[model samples]
Target chain A: MTVETLLLVAAALFGIGVYGALSQQSFVMIMMGLELMLSGAILATGTLWAMAAGGTPKGQLLAIVLVTVMAVEMAIGFALVVNVYRIRKADITEKLKTLRG
Target chain B: MTDVLFWIMSGISVLSAWRVFRTDSMVRAAYWLMVSFAAVAVILVLLSAEFLGLVLLLMLAGEMTIMAVFMVMFMMNPAGLNPMTMVHQHRAAIAAGVLSFLGLGAVGVFGRFPAGVSFATRDVTARLGMELLNDSMLIFQTAGVTLLATMIGALAIASRRGRYGLADEDSIEPAVENSQNAGEGPPSTEKGSA
Candidate 1:
């Protein structure tokens, strides 16, 4: 039951993140979507670890590693956003089509 | 008691997630996202993943605060007060979202899990450390190196050049001329412009 509940929640979060990533025009919103996806992944990992027999500690370790990756990703992403804003004075993702072919 | 706590945390997580997306203001969204992360961390703790829960809370709080600051500093509408639509391609997004959600929900609801019981009584932090060093030491070290590289790369990309490139003899002259040419108080350039 717990595993089912956790999977459902993870699926819901992943769906929402995908929706946000596809729909949102702001860079920050896209980042938020990515964060949501990461959160779902973390939850899934921790829950699966808990439910596994012999308690797979590796899953929990991976979750911690993912959290660190998320932090680093946010740091780099925000810094890039700040740089883009400095250059173009805009933050909307749609307006960033200059590099698109 | 455990089930009740689980339900409460789950409610908070889902509600705060919805609020994060539904709110118009970025700051409000960040605040709601923080709440959602915190609630999820609490749920992780309930599942006997206390170390993972605390790490999630700390990492998410730091990330959200940095994101909020970036939003304030970079977004054209810093206050998030301007009536601007942020979403696009809504119909396709919603359709894809709903399809995936239904598909995943069906799988989760109907799939049969293994009958093995959970062993959740171990101390999470010690076991995690042991596993990291024992089975996945290389992966752990690689992740640490990757984080270091990311930090350095961020600094490299974001750092701005100082006034070394400017003509030292006529720097103030150009500024005065430009200001005088524009009859208004000053050119309405964005902040941080040279």
Candidate 2:
């Protein structure tokens, strides 16, 4: 696939994720949306790197780092959600209005 | 042939990702997200980043399963057996999604990207490790420390209270024997609070 195709897919996924993140009430669902956004970006980046000079390990390293970030972000997100649920007895965005102030 | 495979995988990833929010149940949402990630992994492998793609497939599967466990532990509907709707500002979200897609498509079509294709990646993982250890060790160390801090913070926030969790019900009654009321929602003992 060409770079344009990769980026187009990335943008579409990112858009879907933006919608989900904005519209979803549940924390976990929002996290899923964010993951989708990252997935798209990763695809574009990996494709770009792969299509370029494949002699160096820089591209692979970047992918590894991004994946690590994804894992860590997901872990932290779940932990935060669980903590909130523990305290508030709720997970809906509307119910989390106390944090707004 | 590769283009056909690319389109198929991209379609799968995008559709599954969209389904993640459309699904009524949390477990189904997680599974759909997992499928989306799995498809992305396939695309990454197709792009020649085999190691990263395979790792993502494995990790996302395990993580999504754990997320489902969390869903079962906390959500009112674990199996998605019940149809439940929990969303806000649906029309605005749809509009935003469509707009982004249009804008991005425009950019993709108009923008000039530097292009070339080199296909070497067999020993990339070994070289990646060497580079990390020898040249970019500082970055690796910093990330490791940050991850360590994240683990400690999560433990402090979620685990300090105890393995059973310090429910308000426990504080109020102090006699309830329930640890994980996963089969139910909001806990029966705390119904009065809601």
Candidate 3:
């Protein structure tokens, strides 16, 4: 309800995202973790925009940029995943011990 | 009423996000993430960002579906037919998660923040559109171009064949198809000139 409350929730979400990103072995799952982290960031920025920044469109614009970054990350992440799977038959991060080829 | 709705939506967001990694099935994990984002979208709506909130919901629907499909396609046990733990560094990760939460929560609770309120007399969506076209036009255009480039790059990377040759196969020139050049090595003209 309050700004602090929203920020707390965003922080919690970000923390969960960190845990997931560090723990997950699959590249896809790792990307999911990254997405979660961005989700938290977006929430925090949106909260600031709505409450602290006087609902300025600039804050919203920043949120939009973050979303765009998410999209680009997902697209390229999946593309590299497919490429890795094709080249080395790898989906797990451990399988990729070397970046060669 | 708004306060109650905010609490519920935030609770849903957090719980579903937690469930994203907890779930065994990859597709379930992806959808749980979708649910989490959707809840956050609702919270955004509660915060008076009607356009951004709705747009978030719309985008997540498609994005999460692609995530689910990719998980199924690329993962071995996509459906979680058998129990498998696909994680490492569990203790360290937990510690990091806790530490980050504590650190950020401290900031949220203790930090001094500005108290400016958005007393918008105009519609929020209309204002956003105006901002997009006026000051943020360059940023908007850049994002569009970036998305277009990402689409092309992803397609090129994911495709089995490229301009040169099949990915699995070394960059072998396509055998010359013309009768004069039949069975001959690739011409010196250029590659992919089959």
In terms of TM-score, the best-performing candidate is 3
User: Highest lDDT among the candidates is held by which one?
Assistant: 3
Q: Tell me the tens digit of each residue's lDDT in model 2 across B1-194.
A: 88899999899988988888877778888999888888889988887677778989888888899888887777777677878777799999889988988887787778775556566657766876798898888877877887888888777766636657553334422112222344466775689876
Residue B109, candidate 3: how far off, in angstroms?
A: 1.3
Query: Candidate 1 local accuracy as lDDT?
Result: 0.75
Instruction: Give the TM-score comparing model 1 with the true structure, all chains together.
Output: 0.84
Q: For each model, chain A TM-score? A: 0.91, 0.88, 0.98
For model 3, residues A1-101, the per-residue Cα lDDT tens digits are: 77899999999999999999999999999998899899999999998888888887888999999999999999999999988887777889887766756
TM-score of 2: 0.83
Q: Which of 1 and 3 is ahead in TM-score?
A: 3
Please tell me how candidate 2 rates in CAPRI terms. Answer: medium
Show the lowest summed lDDT stretch of 10 residues, model 3 chain A. A92-101
Specify the highest-DockQ model's number.
2
CA lDDT of each prediction against the hidden true structure: 0.75, 0.77, 0.88
Error of 3 at B9 (Å): 0.7
Least accurate 10 contiguous residues by lDDT in model 1 chain B:
B166-175
